[model samples]
Target: MVRKYSKNDEGVSAVIGVILMVAITVILAAVIAAFVFSMSNGVSKPYTVGITIKKTTSGAVSIVNSGGPDVGQLEHVYVTYQPVNGAAINAYNGEVPADGPDTDTLFDYIEKFDALKTVGGSFTIPAEGVGSPNKVPPTTPTHVIVTGYFKDGKQQVIGEADV
Candidate 1:
């Protein structure tokens, strides 16, 4: 006696189930990867800076980076002078030298004046620029405001001193 076999489709559901599971797993993995990368590559926060100011008899002002963030992390240093009895003005606004703060001694704040490049580094305020010596003369009580700028254009008032 010969036996005849009947065709059946019972395995179709198993194959489709496997495909669906694989697709779901792939999608989940992609989403997780996106979240991980975004968290790891987020923008950096701004840094804090510490500075010291000194005024000379000749009407020259000097500054030193006392503490806070490293010099290489800064993009520029901004200085503003506001006389007690006079209008406020900008003393200096210049980019930090790409080479870093000059190590040579600062004879006067204006001598080899470099924007504060390094911590414990110093620079002179010249008689030039807007709100500078020409406008804010020495011997007058003034408020000096120093700011540190980041490469991203964010800035923070790092130091303030009355001279």
Candidate 2:
């Protein structure tokens, strides 16, 4: 004798299992895509940084402001330095405070005038070390790095070799 098949509760379980699997798969795929997108855009962007330092009798260091100042604006602006044997050191930093000053001045004092106004368009301090008054060599006690953040929401790394 052959057993009779019914659509009562047998094959229904299989169908339900398949449906659950498909739903779970779809949810996982969406989560993965969102994670990847976040990681990609969260770390890459354009920015500008400025560095100012007192010029040695030899090396000529200048700080300039390249391209910045947007609506999103650099929410935060700061600087850090890499020591001769340690990690980067936080040197100087300033902020525009959204509804604050137009120009965020950093390390602006070192000589007869504030270098951040005149030679700060380039956002870099030219150096070759010390002992020439024009080139900063590779043997100085003081060195610095300047980083900039733009309203676009990106971090920029700029440095002014030995100071």
Candidate 3:
């Protein structure tokens, strides 16, 4: 025998079911997003530190330094490689003769330390260990310090470079 259905319960259960389904979907999406973000960072950042000696006949790769009064603007560009233990804030790792804390200091440090050598975004090995006068191979360096003033985001390096 069929039982009598209540009018009040008819729409309420349907709405509750729909709401529960939406909530579950949102929670799962959030959890998935968090996991993916965490994993992506590991893929991007290096686990250790090592200099990438790129074999380029055009004196390796360097940035075009200039000025634009703000970040994201391509201002002064130059070549940077390696780091000094007790080097000054504006000091160059033997890359440039006249070393001083300039606006491009952070970029210099970031480019040098960043293991993600995609296109023109990493340190270069000049003819010699010293980043000056333009040297060549045999004198090419393998290690780099890559020191920055503050954490900023340097902790990203989770590994070292094979080169």
Best-performing candidate as measured by lDDT: 1
Query: Against the true structure, what is every candidate's RMSD?
Result: 9.8, 9.5, 11.5
Q: Candidate 1: worst 10 consecutive residues by lDDT?
A: 105-114
Candidate 2 C-alpha error for residue 163, in Å: 7.9
lDDT of each: 0.63, 0.44, 0.39
Residue 146, model 1: Cα distance from true site in angstroms: 0.8
Question: In model 1, which residue pairs have backbone atoms overlapping below 3 Å?
Answer: 109-124
Candidate 2 Cα deviation (angstroms), residue 107: 9.1
Q: What is the clash count for each candidate, in the order shown?
A: 1, 18, 20
For candidate 2, report its TM-score.
Answer: 0.35
* lDDT by residue (tens digit), candidate 3, 8-119: 7465687899999999999999999999888866554333222233345543332221212222222222233333233322213553324533545446554443323322
Off by over 4 Å in 2: 1-16, 28-57, 68-142, 147-163
Instruction: Please write out the lDDT profile of model 2 over residues 43-147, one tens digit for every residue.
Output: 554444334445446544444444333313544444433435643433322221243223434324222122332334333333442223333232345555554
The order by descending lDDT is: 1, 2, 3
Q: Over the stretch 1-163, how does candidate 1's per-residue lDDT look in tens digits? A: 9999998968668889999999999999999999988897656665777788987767677788877755577766766676667545545433222333232421223323245757778866653324422444533566777767666767677778887
Q: Where does model 3 exceed 4 Å of error? A: 1-12, 43-163
Clashes of 2: 18
Per-model TM-score versus the true fold? 0.49, 0.35, 0.26
Rank by TM-score, highest first: 1, 2, 3
With candidate 1 superimposed using the best TM-score fit, by how many Å does residue 133's alpha carbon deviate from the native?
Answer: 11
Work out how many backbone clashes candidate 3 has: 20
